[model samples]
Target chain A: MDRFRLPAGVRDILPDECARFDAVQARLRERFVAAGFRFVRPAGLEYFDTFAGADSPVAPSAMFKMTDRDGNLIVLRPDMTLACARIAASKLGAESAKLCYFSDVYDFSAAGNSDREIAQAGVEVFGEAGAEADAAVIGFAVDCLEAAGLSAFIVDIGHVGFYKGILEESGLSPAAAEEVRACINAKDAVGTELALRKNGASQRAQRALLALPSLFGDAQVLSEAEKLTDSPAALASLLHLKQVYALLSKAGKEKRVSFDLGTVKSLAYYSGAVFTGLAEGVGAPVLSGGRYDGLCARFGKDLPAAGFAIGMQRVLRALERDKEVRQ
Target chain B: MIRVALAKGRLASSCADLFIRCGIRADILKEETRKLVLETSDGAFKFFFVKPSDVPTYVEYGIADIGVVGKDTLLEAGADLYELLDLGFERCKLCVAGFAGVRPDPARPLRVATKYVHTARRLYASRGEDAEIIKLNGSIELAPLTGLSDVIFDIVQSGGTLRANGLSVLEEVFDISARLIANKVSLKTKAAQILPLLAKMRGELAAKDEV
Candidate 1:
């Protein structure tokens, strides 16, 4: 193999890009430290069993796995949140902790404009549960994005419970629910409708499920969704979002927040609110996080948590795109 | 301005007609032009005429905020973007077509040919069928006739081509139609612009369905 050629999905940061990368990381570090979050660097490699299992946030296929010296399976750190949760639950020995890191995570399956080795700057708040905590994390996301110098962006929020609530009414099996979730996530009404019908979902649930794809945009979305279902869990999810939205508004971060009940991620991973940061020129999310009240429990402790990670490379790309638009 | 990547030819014309009905200044789409990029007179929209398959790539990268492409193209490309609406035109059926009464041998794998290689492989695999898929750029029907494959998998608009070639649809896999897709981020950041246009399109589609 040519020594000059590197493997696909990995790249060297040139001088210009490295300079910008440093600047963004510096800004995010300052913000995190000022906010009382302690810095932590997780091991670059860890036992594969740590992230292996159905409830793991990182998909098994997404991890770079290898055999360790002791013949145990190990993997590159594939997700920052999981790493932080491990640290907080097992090591912190406290009820609450705020931890931050500017680190790179690995994704074996990353391809076609997505990096395999992703540089992420993120913070995780443990032992905090409820809407206020959610809003605070989201507000900080907006603040950090601004601090990183993104001129135009919005934090789109959602709850897994909304979709899960409707699914409770649908009575579909877990596999079928996952299929429908993928369809809704892609906003494919046609696919969603066909799947619901084929699964013999009840008419009421079908109606609510069909509307899931189009249920997005401002605070009005919360009310619009409220009329669709009577499921208490779903309604409670909306109420939680309303509370978070109100808190964000109180902090003058309302304009930076939007709602999308259809942004349904892995229900097994995120317990409540989920969000992604959207910038003017980027197609994919630059920032992503959610409330995972259930993650720490899997690591031998019980703790409620919320946090987010900004893809430093994507943020840099967004800044470059913003400049191009301005020019 | 809202940037749109439109698949050239019939789908583009149909989308332009739909846009016109929705109060968009899409009359320029009817004009024959050597120009690659077309802008609306009001400067509210910009259009890029691209190949059907490339529409998803353009939108997925956010080079185009939204795109109008056929479901077949979308299934094949599988680009990560939001499927917003069903444009309900350029309708067709994706099917497995082959000579009547001809079946794959029990001993060997079934051979299929089509441009939609990914969609074909997925269809057969999901059914737990072992099949050799041969990808053809065009003239998919010729594959079965030339003994290149046992069957052809492709979009059937009226079954005219398949019938003319002494073939019939063995299995209907997916219903194909033009769909409206948007960049995920664009759907949020440009909601003010995209949502209103989507509302107009939805209204027009509803009216059409009513009639």
Candidate 2:
């Protein structure tokens, strides 16, 4: 057997790549610090139950599991946001804190265009709420990508409340809603229609749900979506997003931001506006985060929070593509 | 420029025609040339002709901003991308085929042979059935003919080949057709270029539907 070979989806960084990686990390560290975000290093390993029990945002199969010395189950930290939230709530001893981390998180089931060992530079703001906080986090995401030397990128934003509101009136079961969410996330109108019809969704709900896939673009999408539903929650989410967009526009960050009401990620913990950083030369989001107001509450504190994590390798890939395109 | 990966041959030609209808300078696709890559005179688009299965890999890696491939290939590769539209051409059916009236015994795990290993496995697993999927690159019908497997899972545009080989479709699975896909990141980053093309394609498809 070849002992030198690394596992699939994992990579060993050599000197050249390591140098680039370190430079990106250093730049992000400076940015986080200057922004009043305190650094925290959560344990690399934690009890599996911390992320696997009822109402858990993460799936157990997505975690790399192992047994501790005491015969209890443990996992190789599959997510950074959950760990930071745990610390901020259970250990930080503060009602509000802006925490940052440069951490490597592991995902066992990551395949097909995603890495297993992900180097993530992330920031989580605890005890913050409202459109201002959402805009600041998204604008910072844009700034963070710029700091990492990306010439072009956009923070595509959305809100979970919009989807939640539509689903609330759909009369579909929770399982059916999750199925439709996956379909919508993939932008598979075919599958979405199949799932919605199979679940006997109302005609109005079907039209609204079907339109979700196309409900992405500039701020005009906010108005287009406004006409789709009268659900108070969905409308309120749109108003909040409008307020956030206005703030961003006033700050001249409008060019770097766009709205995608269809950006409903599978991360069930997200409570408010969520956004993903998309750039040229990368097929996936280079950065992802959102508001998870109830996450800290799960960790024994009820602090409204929002933040984002940059996929270090994807950012580097985009940089490499930039150089290649230039030459 | 919007980069597109086309599955060489019929799919590529059909996509070229669609692009022409949408006002893209894809006339070069009709010429007889040995080149693998083709760029239009206006330089608004570049086309890469590749193996049918490699189309998704290119789009998923962002090497190509968008791609046109069969849903069957998409199911097998299972690459992460946005399924933007159904081109409505190259229609076919993924089916489970073998000798007529022959059913697998419930006691043993049925052995199936096909190039679509992943799709086959998923089909059976979802139904709570045990299936031993045998991967064969070509001539999947030979597996059932030679008794190497009980059935073959493959795309069937017509029943001529199966009928001549004394085989019949046992069950129809997924409806296979050519689909337009876009990279998740490219859809947003290049929306100015890609979205307009998508709208035009939709218009073209709508016009065709009316006809």
**TM-score per candidate:** 0.98, 0.97
CA lDDT scores, all candidates in order:
0.93, 0.92
- Which residue pairs collide in model 1, if any? none
Clashing pairs in 2: none
Best by DockQ: 1
After superposition, candidate 1 runs with Cα above 4 Å error: none
DockQ score of the complex predicted as candidate 2: 0.80
TM-score of 1: 0.98
